[model samples]
Target: MTKSRIRAAKPDTQPHFDYFYDKPGSLPGTLNIGVDAQPPVIVLIDYNEADATRQTLATPEECLPYLDTESVSWVDVQGLGSEDILQRLGQVFNLHPLVLEDIVNVPQRPKVEDDYEDHLVMIARMVIPKESGGFHSEQVSFILGKHYLLTVQEEPEHDCFEQVRQRIRYNKGSVRKLGADYLAYTLIDSIIDGFFPVLEAYGEQMEDLEDEVITKPTRQTLNKIYRVRRELLNLRRAIWPQRDAIAMLIRDDNDSLISDRVQVYLRDCYDHAVQILDMVETYRELTSGLMDVYLSAVSNKMNEIMKLLTVVSSIFIPLTFIAGVYGMNFNTEKSPWNMPELNWYWGYPLCLAAMAATAAGLIYFFWRRGWFENFSDVQDRTSRKRG
Candidate 1:
């Protein structure tokens, strides 16, 4: 099995900037985007209660006319490789300088800010599906205006907004009746709920590790437990700040951009965030206990090894001394005192009998004192029973 490697990460090694930085206090609406980003793909979804029109546009300027229209316009930009296109996108959307900078930055902390413009900027994170049971997450920024919502994703392929698109296209939900704020809420809620299945998978893994660590801990087992712990820490870091961001959205009395109804829904999203936090915390605690149990298990195995060595030495040390004494020749023919036993007819049998008695007595002593029973129990539990 391929397990994630256990490596230590220093605070210094943590990311200073999630993405390449633009100069501080750069002109408002200036685009200092990444060089390696893919060319932006714009998906325009214009919708109202009676009708909806979805189109793919060639340039950011093409979506400009609908921004001031009566219907709700959602301009979704995925991928950010071309600086020229991104800079134009900032102009077309009339985004604040800081808002544009936040969108281009790949991994900004999830946040919501209102800078006294016609927009409410929300920095939400999205986690993509992992093929190998691991996760990769990216940042998605939402700029909500009076009649339009502009969304920009870090990468082209990582998207979780398909459900919201379907809701609008198929008119499956109340999305058509709501404004851009509701659309923002729907997308944000989807992003928050995305963490659940990932967290559930982690919970199951930790439960499995709990069994694996205690029953048959090895060096490899230690690595796996630590890997799980490290990943949980990452998950905690992701979910915790997100919870605070959502809380801020609910608690901010100044940002009246989100209506009371949407704020109520944001409360539900907060609950989900709380649930995720609880699971991450619980898993962390379990992982810590597994570490302790692994240490004790390793120590116990070492002790058993020492005990076996002691038992072997105790049984053989005296026997070896007796054999050594007999093997010595002290001039037996000239000294009767030393040669009396050696000359006896049954001397060999008597000496063998004495060794046998000595071995039996030691064995009985160990058995009676429960040392053997303890060893047997350890073997039975570790070998015969399923951990």
Candidate 2:
């Protein structure tokens, strides 16, 4: 099997799980935007059955005229750069204070809320794969009303809504003819489908790790396995709740916020979410198994090393004993028994031959027991396989 090597990432460099929150005992609808947050960019796309118009509005007030129209209006606000702009957006759309807060303070759990009679708030997470490896997650909040859909994304850089926008702009699908609710469903579907490519990358990474763990596990392999596991865990946390949110969108339609047609589409999106979750869970299990395999491989390698050492020691035992006995001072001048061998002309040569014979016999014995065969043949076989 081909060996797979992954560069291990430091623990400190791992993605953080910290979420934003309001201060304890603070006001109910306080907006706490990140200091590093980019400034908000507001783009409006208004369309009806007859025609569609796309415009880059300078202010949130320009969206008011389109929102109250009969056509479906999509107000895409990318970034939470300024609190004043977001607050004005909330006023322009008549958004609930709590709704605006949720949109601003991101990293919220994926959920759907119907606190207002005229609007439904849905929070979803979108994961974008990094060029090097791994993924970055951001929150995308949706506010669906009678004739308008407002989407607030944490950052303006990466999103899965481009295809949805193309469909709206080109009138590729039934999106142009649908209401705001259908538009909301389309964006949500895009978000769900975005997970596939990221999950596929992880799947391939896991396969590589599986081979590396079993064949030639190293400290770096252990670290890579742990990193993959941690990433999978983060993926699970992001998708599990999103799945429930989609299911809730399909199951609970008390306010009739989602049309029957859109509900059917949401069901498909929900299935995709479930599939992504299943893949993540399976990869997680495989990574966990890889960790166990790594441990066994290390242990087996150590065992082989020790076995070779023992064989060498066994062969030298008798040779060392013979040399020691010959070197001992036995008073050969006074004792006849000890003096007989000491006086022999061939005694030194015979002792050397005996020691050599003892070592050769033990080596043959070990070879016959297949001890030497294992280490000698193992490397050859591995090389042949690689070739």
Candidate 3:
């Protein structure tokens, strides 16, 4: 009947859960890019101690000359629009078939592989919050070589690597003097830092939900709690393996591709990942608690409503019995005990007065027992606080 009641009665839409996976019994090295994937854009940044250069290259072959030089070349390929271009880029960089497959795939578990003699393969998921709400996750694959580092992203619209690019462009913080391994660490660190903003957004959302659940929980509050829990679960899934990957890069030195100095930086990155995971887990637990609170709040509200109905029914039971007895078809003239009062003029007025007195007495009893005090004022206070 009212806007608030209508809103509270509406059902929540179900959430969608999705993940990327290959078909059963399919090939091990299969590339399955999404149909909506954006076209590729290649950008090269080559630098030495003395100078730095950034360019948008037309072809993957153009990166070959810079790769062979003594300068550190960063070939950043954004988006996976064309299979042909991706394959050609792989060929130009001498990427292993399996490595290329991993790069082209839209979603892959975060991991690091040092099996290749000349290069290191690292797969990481990067997440950024959307303008509306929630977050967007994209898989970023890295191929680290002696003189160059190849980075591939699933989409071109969003990335957190712009700050790292700025650092390299300006030769700030000894980035130009460092090796490509250090460059990889810088980018990884940037990726790890990006998680903080998304986590902060969820933290604020959870706080608001906490207040809502305690004060004025509705079906929408329950839905919001579940949604926060689910998103935090996704965040945990993305960060856990990434932490292990960075730890592996630090502990395992079989390939000797990562320098000792860069490993120190990676250890810091690993700490950041662990911190992110801890926050995610904590928030998830809080959301679970919020769900419990929501259920309890709903039950309490229902109990209050039922109690009020019970009191009203109890007050009317005796009055209804009196009315039923007076309405019975008794022969007033046949027996004096049957209805002598029915012939009296004051009988009707007396009966009405008696019913009124009974109702007033019962109401006074309930009021004295504090039943009525708990009904209206407490609910009004709660509603005002919620508003």
Q: Name the candidate that leads on lDDT.
A: 2
Expressed as tens digits, the lDDT of each residue in 1-387 for candidate 2 is 111122235644434364556655678777876778999999999999888889888999988788778999999999998989999999998888988887888778899987688888899999888888888788999999999999999977988899888888788989988899999989998888888888889988988988888878899999999888988888898899999989888876534778888888988899889999999999999988898899999999999999899889977977779778777767777878765877789988997887789778988997898866767688999999999
The TM-score of candidate 3 is 0.82
TM-score of each: 0.79, 0.82, 0.82
TM-score between model 2 and native: 0.82
Cα lDDT tens digits, model 3, 67-117, are 778899999999998888888898898888788877876566799998888
Candidate with more favorable, higher lDDT: 1 or 2: 2
Sort all candidates by lDDT, best to worst.
2, 3, 1
Candidate models: Cα lDDT each: 0.79, 0.85, 0.84
Q: Cα lDDT for residue 199, model 1?
A: 81
Predicted candidate 1 versus true structure: per-residue lDDT over 1-387, tens digit per residue:
111122235542223234334455555545545556788899999999899999999999998799888899999988877877888888887776667767876666778787656777788778765767757777888888888998888886877788888899899888999888889889988988888877878877887877887788889888878777777777777778889888877875635578888888889999999998998899889889999999999999999999899989987998788889688766767877776877779988998898889789988997998866766788889886775
Model 1 deviation from the true structure expressed as Cα RMSD, one decimal place: 7.0
Query: What lDDT would candidate 2 get against the real structure?
Result: 0.85
Worst 10 residues of 1 by lDDT: 1-10
Q: What does candidate 1 score on TM?
A: 0.79
